[model samples]
Target: MFIQNALPQKPNLWKYIIGLIVVVFFWRGLGSIPLIAAMFTKASDLGSIDMTPAGLADLLGANLFLSVMLSSFVLGLIGLFLYVKFVHKQSIRSLTTSREKIDWGRIFFSFFVTILFIGGFLYAGVMMEPDSYQWNFNKEAFIILAAIVLLMLPLQTSFEEYFFRGYLLQGLGVATNSRFWSLVITSSLFGLMHIFNPEIQKIGYAVLTVYIGLGFLMGIMTLMDEGLELALGFHAANNMTIALMVTTDWSALQTDALYVSSAEPDLGGMLLFLGGMFVVLLGIFALRYRWKNWGNKLFGKALVLEEETTA
Candidate 1:
């Protein structure tokens, strides 16, 4: 039903291809100008600057750097909306869910549940390995960071969801005529998008399993639930929690979080632990949402009804 929302318009594959280019130009090209200008100014002052997340965060100050970095996504989201509305002739609500309206209830439920889970895990980790974390709370900096996270971070995460889970997922599903291929391609692309993150360098390419795994989890959620609400909420909460609770040298974004971790991440152990947690979460979601028709929803053919095409 969600994928079929694209049926009435019959948007060709080329539209998606060109849409991606437009979104990327807005996100990476136009959006990066401010960051580039800031870096250039900093380079002139320091005679040189390191071209890394940490370096940029340090040079521009963490909050300012983060705001500028996330601004790109805000622009990208705008571009996506324009394309979806005009080029695709699809309503934003249709892109988001198959429901008559956007389900704020589901989004909030997933958001709060994920936040609680992440908070509890962080608390337990801190308790178990006290030496691995250092208190890094700064009253002023944290307030600023919180404001930015509350406002800008959602836009960034939303942009990703709209692109990956919403736009691209639907496009691929209709194009390939199979939910399975759509899931696989989008999930893998989502994972590969993070290949250059600082954490990958610290933890090795094996970390891609975690990224790809999470993508699959979200894709599965989208397919089973027939909406992007849960995935969007989960993603926002996951990043927001990490941004607020913990920071590490090798993190993708170095934030003024409440705690800084010095622990060397154990890749294998982390994989096992996260894998177990993902399974449990999936089970819980399935139960809560009363998900059924697993075989059809996940692997079924994406069919466009004749009536829908005529309408």
Candidate 2:
């Protein structure tokens, strides 16, 4: 089974929530038409919006961050809120699986480990090229920009995480009475959603094999760990570092970063990314969460053929 199917069944509400999400996606993509027609479809301009090729292309024609946020990001959030409040009939605490309430330990552990990982890379980069990275420390301007980005960007990233790995994972698991299919469908959709990223254009579609692999990795973490806390922390750290530490002309999430790497992103970096994610997964597994049915949890069928199955 992919999900435990332990939650109280609520089919009618679930349908409404799903409808709202579809509506949000429709408007978001459709609404981008005007922006796309305005810009010549430049990647850099869209990077400022949310780092996706579609959004960046829109920026190429019309580089207005506010419109993108107002039309797409905010609409999505409002839809999510409606889903949670009206459709799911769930509180934030309930949606997060508050068996013991919020798990601060898991969140902090993942957060601290990510800080160390990113710090190690930064240290290595500095040692390798001291003169390559000049500090961009306009404190006043940066502080304001940082505040704006921090406030806005997390909504975009967190919405993806909660929707794909948390809300969808849990809902589908419950709906199907299986955990396995939840992971498969959720992770597959997550990766497919990124197909239009500018990085795919610059680095080839093969890079997304690793990306799909990552979706599986994070999905496994959510299912095995039975929560999104760790995945959330890791994702937040990964993106926050990219937003604050490095900015590339071809990269998503272009910002006033601390350093700009001259080296092109390569296959080696993709391998390293996969390697690092597995390492973290291994560490979590080593913590002995007592996770069970490893194969079924990740790759098996989600349907519960037997009533006695616990999922």
Candidate 3:
């Protein structure tokens, strides 16, 4: 597969470790510097970044916060790229899949599919509150904003997926000598990382069941498919839909997206999220991707690598 070719024919454990640390320093540590400064300066509380466009605008204006957040991601990207290119000595494409190149088809297909799915929700919102919706259609600014959001946001989401599900999943799998452990660890960490999200506070801890469930879904898809394509598509679509379709008083990302929605989230409880997740999992299984040794895959031990060589 194209992804296989992208990886180091022989894994280099040291490079992976160093690269992860480098990524964390830049993407996370450096990224938080601005927020930290703001906290100390009393410029603004961290929780102020809201779901509305105006709220997003305020946060973006904070140079330190923006610098740290964006630079950290860039740093992480560079670190991962270097690991893939030099340590693994593999083409960028192989890192994602065994494909020779990025399958624009997969990306677009997922994009459109997600749009259609979320578009349904948007339609419902509009139907419910026709007067509440308004289009601030400035051709030029809208175009630029759309481009920026679509391009940059997807990169951000993809970075998360690659790092957590792809790189971390593989590394942990090799380290623990068990894919199951890797999946559990990766998914758990993924969900835990979002504990600080503003949405949790707005909607309550019940919403986190959805977040963690979503993480598990993404991670499981990666493990079952033996690649990140499906998860990447699903995640990009999910985020893009959220970005473009809705805006609320209490949500995480604030962007000048296409549609400004005012719908209070109904699926704000654990039971709803679990039910939704169960449905999605069933659908995936219906598609016949649920392979043999199911019990082992979800919670089995990972394969251990030799100490001397990870290749």
Candidate 4:
């Protein structure tokens, strides 16, 4: 039923694939414009600015750098919009959910739950190692950072959620005719997308394990719930809380956060916290929604090739 939502749209397989490629190419190319300008400004040479996250942060200034990157996701959103509107001949609503209307309740519930969940992690870490963090708050800068985050963070997180859990999840399910493969493929891609983040450079590739794990959890939420609401809410909350609460030289989002962590990441603690939080969040959703059909929802082959061919 999830992938079948695409049936009425009559999508062309090749067009969907090619269109995404074109959109991403253009969108990413445009995001590079500011970085290009920064390079020239910094050393009077086009290639002077190193392409690392920290390098860009140094050259562009933290706030301007983040604004530029977040704006690129807005472009990605537009590309996805163009594809759904013209190429797929479908409404964004269908891409979002199987329900008659968007589920704001699920979104809000997941959002608040994630805030508390991650808030706990931060508190525990601080309690355990008080000296590891520095209060980085500058009230004027924080107000400015919060303003930017409130406005642009949603666009950044939503762009990723819609593209991954919504658009690509649905697209792959329909393309492969198998929801299980769809979930795995999209989640892997989601993880790999962050492989180039500054965290990888700081903490090494082990952090990718955490990224991929989070991907699977979000993918599970989307597949089992038959909507992007939970995934979108949880992701938005995750990023928003981090952007507001903390930052590090090694983190992907090196913003003017309230607290800055000076210690290297505890890989084991990171995994444990992520895994534990994921299970707890899943439990909350399971009980509240009374989710059923675990064997089928998470792993069942929903779109058989022959069945789709016949249909």
Task: Report the number of the highest-TM-score candidate.
Answer: 1
Q: Each model's TM-score?
A: 0.95, 0.76, 0.73, 0.93
For model 2, how does the per-residue alpha-carbon lDDT over 1-311 read when each residue is reduced to its tens digit?
A: 22333254354545747755664574476555655544434444543564453345345421244335424554565566566666666665555543457676776677667757776786687678866666665666466546655666556666667678766787777666667777778888888877876778888887777777778877777776667777766666667666677666666555656666666778777778678768765466547466776776565544445554645
Q: Comparing candidate 2 with candidate 4, which one achieves the higher TM-score?
A: 4
Residues 212-294 of candidate 1 have per-residue lDDT tens digits of 88889899989999999999998999899999999888888789999999999888877786676577767878998999999
Model 1 — which ten-residue stretch has the worst lDDT? 42-51
RMSD of each: 2.4, 5.3, 5.8, 2.7
C-alpha RMSD of candidate 3: 5.8
> Whose lDDT is greatest here?
1
Error of 2 at 219 (Å): 0.7
Candidate 3 backbone clash number: 20
Q: Tell me the lDDT of model 4 at 171.
A: 79
Ranking by lDDT: 1, 4, 2, 3
lDDT of 3 by residue, 1-311 (tens): 22223234656578678868877776787666655665546545556545333454464542223233444555566667776677666665656654456666655655665566556756776787887776644566456556655666677778888788877776676666666677778888887777877777667776666777777887776665556776788788877676655555566655555556565566544456456645654364436444565665566545423553355
lDDT of 2 at 5: 31
- 1-311: candidate 4 lDDT, tens digit per residue: 55667778766778777867956865687756765665566667645556777777788777877888787888888888887888888888888888888999999999999999998788777788889989888998788889998898888888888888888888788787778899889889989999888887777888888988889999899988999899988998999899888888877787888898898878898899888977899999999999999888878775645665588
Output the better candidate (1/4) by lDDT.
1
The alpha-carbon deviation from the true structure for residue 84 of candidate 4, after best TM-score superposition, in angstroms, is: 1.1
For TM-score, candidate 1 versus 2, the one ahead is: 1
Candidate 1: Cα lDDT at 154:
92
Report the CA-based lDDT of candidate 3 relative to the real structure: 0.62
Alpha-carbon lDDT, every model: 0.90, 0.63, 0.62, 0.83
